[model samples]
Target: MKSRFTPLLAGLVLAVSSLTVQADEVQVAVAANFTAPMQKIAAEFEKDTGHKALLVFGATGKLYAQIKNGAPFQVFLAADDKTPAKLETEGDTVSGSRFTYAIGTLVLWSAKPGFVDDQGEVLKKGAFKHLAIANPKTAPYGAAAVATLTQLGLLDAIQPKLVTGENISQAYQFVVTENAELGFIALSQVMADGQMTGGSAWVVPSNLHDPIRQDAAILAKGRNQPAARALVEYLKGDKAAAIIKSYGYAL
Candidate 1:
């Protein structure tokens, strides 16, 4: 009986060893607004690293809460500099691994044809009854929306006509669903397949708001994970920067 069991035990050990060798998949927490580009980048990352990326996409604030609760995210790709800075202050990150991957843009987007215009002067004209924005308290895109309005001197004038989404991605959904005639959303949300959507958009002027410097950082969970660090460095490379630019983000 002992002799017969030896072969079975040896086979089980080999199977476990094989599985362990392929378990280098990195768990990444990405902002929801970055869903599209991150998908493309991950494909490239896998091709180069032979390590798969397990991406979790959502609002930066919500992801922050999840991380605080010990979610197994090995790294964070946040839409704002604030959250990553906070995490580092709290000692939740691997020291010296944080860096800005992209500068995001906010746009006044609409699904209805001819609704938006080149310079976005249509907002002052009040062509649409409602304007959409992400919740300014949590989503960085939301803050950009507010800044754009304030910079255009229309925030108070259009206060009553504003609708809000919990996150920038949801704000885009509001416009798509016609819940709001127009909403402020991340540029990537409307740029699909390397093209802009049907309606016109005025990419918000960068000077109107604080720069949306999207910071990526390795979590404490990935302290010794070279793949996580390599992934961050990979993003600064030519291929990844191209992916980032194709999505309407500035690297």
Candidate 2:
């Protein structure tokens, strides 16, 4: 029995080797705030090219740390330019593959109607019991939320009511689940077909905070791969950019 089993081991290896030689999946590390859009983009990208996007969503900072520690992601679509720029400076990314894909918008949103009015001084009015924001320490969007509140002179007034999510996606979840009466989140979190749905929002005037510019870059892990380079180039094309803009992002 041992001799018979040993003879088939080489055949088994040949079968597995054939499968490995055929299919290659492109792994991408994406920001949590990009969940919906990336899912859509991945589908479109898969259809356009034979390659598939093995999408992983997490905070941009965490993804950076993971990549530094040898996570095998080929591309990174960060929530901000900082991480990508740092990767480039650290020689962890392809020099020319960096590009801004979209300008994100921060909004104060609520699942319930009239729960948020970004322009109506809702925070200063003190109408809500709780306001959720992402943990500014980890999320760029959350940091921007803090910056916006500070710029409006409402940071002090809103401090006590703040509830922090581990990331922007969770912050949106807090508002959606009614755990938070209102919260600051990425505008894309609530947008569909280039418009907002379900609740009223003020669209937080851009002047109140720094722009939310999302950038993508091909990591060193992908510098030598044609499929990864193709994906990065496709993201910059008119078709992909159009889809990005349709999801309430400004390209």
Q: What are the per-residue Cα lDDT tens digits for candidate 2 across 103-142?
A: 8988888888876665747877898888999888778899
Task: Assess candidate 2 and give its TM-score to the true structure.
Answer: 0.89
| Candidate 1, residue 122: how far the Cα is off, in Å | 1.7
lDDT of 2: 0.86
lDDT scores for all predictions? Answer: 0.88, 0.86
Q: Which RMSD values do the candidates have, in order?
A: 4.1, 5.9
Model 1 misplaced regions, further than 4 Å: 1-23, 192-194
Of candidate 2, the 10-residue stretch with the lowest lDDT total is 18-27
Candidate 1, backbone clash total? 0
